[model samples]
Target: MTLTSIPIALTIAGSDSGGGAGIQADLRTFAFHRVHGASAITCVTAQNTLGVSRVDALPSAAVAAQIQAVVQDIGVQAAKTGMLLNQEIIATVSEQVAACKIVNLVVDPVMVSRTGAQLIDDSAIAVLRSHLIPQAAILTPNRYEAQLLSGLEILTLEDMQAASEKIFELGAKSVLVKGGGMSGELRGVDVWFDGNACETLTTQVVNTPHTHGTGCTLSAAIAANLALGKDLRSAVHLAKSYVTTALKYSLAIGKGQGPVGHFFPLLLSDS
Candidate 1:
């Protein structure tokens, strides 16, 4: 069927009251790509650039209702999920994705914090692996998260490839093991693996401390590109480039680590 307006992308995630990450970052990235953005917020966090002060998770029913509301009327072309805080939320999300038949799904396994802390318990990780991840078109996990999901410590490029392969075996169509948290030379490199081939995707690394929501932005950009009709590899490639450029213009808001400038081009022109 032929369409008229811009493509739509949906993000099921927690709400970052700070507006640096979570649903806030996802929507901004969608807008940057000219995609209509919708969201189903699973949890609410009282956070800022400094840190998360508190968290309040929505009921599983409420989260599912939001997804139903969006898919029933708005209809997403591609969707992504981040920060499903627990097993109930994970199961609810998986049910909705299947009911809606959401094929272009990006799963950012937000099980570990950027600071290398585990955010979810072992039970939640197990639930995510068994329920939510198998529905994903692409699974995007940072090094620490990759270790948890794939049961392997990812310290080298070879380890990243092996983890990607292991995660791919869990039924995701593809897997991307993000190496941003790796130290030394391995940092900022990512390994992408589908069932057939493994590829390394690299971009000019932007040296900046103001990177609060890099992963969310990258995955959201990939979903937007998917909605815009890009193939999976091209979508990931373009998303990485977008994140790199955004990092070059990362914002210096609040007192701690700030957010990447989602509208860097516009902000630069306005300046």
Candidate 2:
């Protein structure tokens, strides 16, 4: 019998004990796309649907070791970073990414929440902008994050386009300004900008409160598609479609908010 080799994707993120976001969601997204998933957890969070209670970041050396272990042996076709908790970790991860030469990188700048709240400190954000983001093949930032990065207000599609361009100037090959944090008709309308072209991507809004891991899932889906040999634009579109379908069947578990159903096809079959 011959064994077939599968495309592999790596998720360098934090761990969510609630099983809604971070490494958990990324791994699930990778599996759904039939890509072998590797992970290097950056931090451990004690949280559930309601909120995050505690977060303990791992040592920089430990995170580097994990990356080395995976890249040296198992290998990865694409990689992503979620929450690099602090400056030290972010800088370390950035260095490791450069050292490992992981080119197909998707960076979900998890610096702000969908509600416009900042997640990391100024120093960490600075280091992430200076180091890691420039190496990204695709930089995915939510509305608030886009605003912070571009120093502009994102209230319309045009604003999103402009923001994408500004972020693209930061050295990322491409930029995606996510609209999950937008309001009215602008919501769910993402803007994509490469060096040459800028476009808006609209998908059917899956009205659900259980959107805990949508950001992580979308980025992971992008990485999975890249691992499967899709171009950047096609990868983003397919990933958006996958997230939309998953959102349609989003799980309604836990108290505050659950998660998007990464395995929505199984839910359909079970129903």
Worst 10 residues of 2 by lDDT: 1-10
For model 1, the run of ten residues with the poorest summed lDDT: 1-10
How many clashing pairs per prediction, in order? 0, 0
TM-score of each: 0.97, 0.98
In candidate 2, position 11 carries an lDDT of 99
lDDT tens per residue, model 1, 47-73: 999999999999999999999998899
| lDDT of candidates 1 onward, in order | 0.93, 0.95
Please give the distance, in angstroms, between residue 123's alpha carbon in candidate 2 and its true position after superposition.
Answer: 0.6
Report the Cα lDDT for candidate 2: 0.95
List candidate 1 stretches off by more than 4 Å.
1-4
Top candidate on TM-score is: 2
Q: Which candidate leads the pack in lDDT?
A: 2
lDDT assessment of candidate 1: 0.93
TM-score of 1: 0.97
